[model samples]
Target: MKQFPFFIILLFISSCQYFEKQIPSEKELLQKELKSINWKEVDEFPSVVDCEKVNDKKLRQQCFFEVMAQLIQEKLDIDTLSILYPELDTIEVKVTIFPNSSMKFEPQFSKDSVAYDTIKIDSILQARLVDFPKVNPAIKRGVPVKTQLILPIIIKAKEEKK
Candidate 1:
């Protein structure tokens, strides 16, 4: 029987390492680049008229909020409400802007004092919002997104001391 040299066998075994393949196990497939993400926050906030020109994100947000507050303050008949409901000094409205440019509002007044009828306030709010111009909605990943804004309005009586 012909005998093979042990050195030649070692050299052949070493050369086989070049063809060795790396087969990833199930762990590689199960591992994720990102385990979680924040979907609630939008990349851009809803912009009001004339606020689109602002480029800085923080400034844009500020302008948006300012414009919205101004619009609501100008449009709503808060003075009348203050005169009618002397007890309620503050009110909160939860406004939501949808991607379709439509808005939804939920008015919240002080329930303990019961100064004014909420139904009447709700109706007045709805009518006032009708005059508000449709605004550009928030954006997320280059897509328009729905956003919510809480507006707190303080209505003081005309005779009350500051």
Candidate 2:
């Protein structure tokens, strides 16, 4: 019977520690507040790229591929496209449109070394489109708003020498 009270006290101490660690820091609290703002509200559709609304899904997919191609070309600026690996040389970029009037972009590569090499040269862009800039205000939305986007770029790395 005496051990019962000690067990309860131990439980209380452990629970108290857990709650203490869960307390949000000031920065986290502020970020949550900022994210809660009504940034997705829109009176009209956005006017970024030229396309018909009837084929939004199809057109968006094509547009994303086009954008990816453009970014790839930009990356290869002033450089000749060598036959690095005819069988393995390839890149893919994906753009995801969100229901919340936002978009996300991602790039994936078949070769893991390509991803690693990209990070080594430009650590900021392992799966990121360093060429694409932030969407301009005019192209973002018809109404004043804020949105978050993610873009990824994948590149094929050359085989290393022994």
Candidate 3:
């Protein structure tokens, strides 16, 4: 009978370790979660009011990109970029959208584009690209995040000579 009681005490002492699990600190848990996340991709792309109604993720992204490109094209059409650089048919623009809904547009030029006046083109783009429709910032893990997109804008289409 005494041995049975001793065995019970030993079992209880050994089982205490199974119940005593070391809880991780909040900071440690947060750091671990952050490490597991892929920072390169966002859950949702930055969008305009028109694209917000889109339910499909891929379609929504496409709508946002299309709208942005169209808006940029329209805005630049009023500028003299085509006249300034007749040979330049396309311009690669780097667009940065902030979490606060503000945006920045920068022209990307190739290394061989030394003949083009990059400063003037950049100034024209900066001056022309403004007052856009309200853009909802990208979402990552349910939080608003800044995102950047590279879009190619057609300066002017060549007319086919008959």
Judging by lDDT against the true structure, name the best candidate.
3
lDDT of 1 by residue, 21-80 (tens): 887776765464223435778888998768889999999999887787777766664447
Candidate 2's C-alpha runs over 4 A off are 1-47, 52-57, 78-88, 94-107, 111-118, 121-162
Superior by TM-score: candidate 1 or candidate 2: 1
lDDT of each: 0.77, 0.46, 0.93
Q: Clash number for model 3?
A: 0
Task: Please give, for residues 1-162, the per-residue lDDT of candidate 3 as tens digits.
Answer: 869999999999999999999999999999999999999999999999999899999999999999999999989887788878989989999999999999999999999999999999999999999999999999999999999999999886334213
Candidate 1 C-alpha error for residue 51, in Å: 1.1
TM-score of each: 0.71, 0.31, 0.92
Model 1: CA > 4 A from native: 1-35, 110-113, 156-162
Error of 2 at 101 (Å): 8.8
Predicted structure with the largest TM-score when compared to the true one: 3
RMSD of 1: 5.6
Pitting candidate 2 against candidate 3, the one with the higher lDDT is: 3
Q: Could you tell me how far off, in angstroms, the CA of residue 117 lies in candidate 3 after the best superposition?
A: 0.5
